[model samples]
Target: MLDRVITISREFGSGGRELGMKLSEKLEIPFYDKELISLTAQETNMSVTEFLNYYESIPVTEQSLEPPLYTSFSPLYEIPISDQVFLAQSRVIKSLAEKGPCIIVGRCADRVLEDSINLFIYAGIEHRIERIISLNKDLDPQLVENKIRETDRKRKDYYQYYTGCEWGKAQNYHLCLDSGLAGVEGCYQAVLSYLGHCI
Candidate 1:
């Protein structure tokens, strides 16, 4: 049996990816984040750009289990592009979990992998904005804030559309950490400590 799998879902500007990478290194396990996009593209024989476009988008038809009051139609709708991408990625995630322990970041791995430790990482908007500004010092603060809001909105929509659950809801995850409060290193240590006790 696979010993342990950790899935992290994060707010757009949160340090979840950094924490995940650090935790993976500390635990000596493989890590999947942007790497998942490449793997899924290879598996589906689709271009990376195509996968990136539909990476976390949901089909309009799947906006709700029940029909919506109004529906917008698109050529891609017929192809179910988002569904195809998600299914391909889902297969890859399951395969990786079955192979052994690993850390998966984003792409809804928490929903794809059974018996995995699911963590939701979030930070206050002010903290997120500050982090983004620090990383991209040349960018305007307003632009950075707008970008963060848009990315987080897309992530939330994609996760909810696919999983039928609200993103960042504490109830949906095994643990919820405020990366803003703990910082990346502190959060990594906390996750390690939790894993040590649980697994």
Candidate 2:
């Protein structure tokens, strides 16, 4: 009965990566995150950085945005380097899931595997300045907070463009967690328990 797949989408500063890693270890399954990005790069014969840039935002034309037409770009317009990477990565993800159970982090995995169990995590302190300072000892709190905000904006924009869904919206996932509330280890266990029930 080990035919379940788990997809985790998270906000910036959340310990989603850590949670995915821990859960993978506990479940004894392959975990994919940035590694999937790298693998996509390899499969598509594109550089990792190039794939990352195209990963989320494919260019759209002005004509497509017209009020009357409200037309969307042809699927080919989404065929830039990163979009192709996503296709390759998605194929890999499907192959992995079909082969057995696995955990995927980010890369719009929830959307890619819409039928699979999806969990979204958002871990942010009300005061990001403090969280940044705690997470990165070398960086100043103010700078870290600024970085977090900027990074989060990019992630949101990317997700919206690629998945046609708002990032961090609770409705997008089966479970939405706050790492700051659950703590990293607790979140890990929560995911495991969630999978147990899902199976």
Superposed Cα deviation of residue 8, candidate 2 (Å): 0.8
The pairs that clash in candidate 1 are: none
* Model 2: colliding residue pairs: none
lDDT of 2 at 49: 70
TM-score of candidate 2 on Cα atoms, chains taken together:
0.80
RMSD of each: 4.7, 4.1
Model 2 clash tally, residue pairs: 0
User: CA lDDT of 116 in candidate 2?
Assistant: 75
In terms of lDDT, the poorest run of 10 residues in model 1 is 67-76
lDDT tens digits by residue: candidate 2, 142-179: 66767778878877876776667888888888888877
- Candidate 1 residue lDDT tens string, 15-108: 9889888878878889999898899999878888777887777776544353221122343245476777777788899889988899999988
TM-score of each: 0.88, 0.80
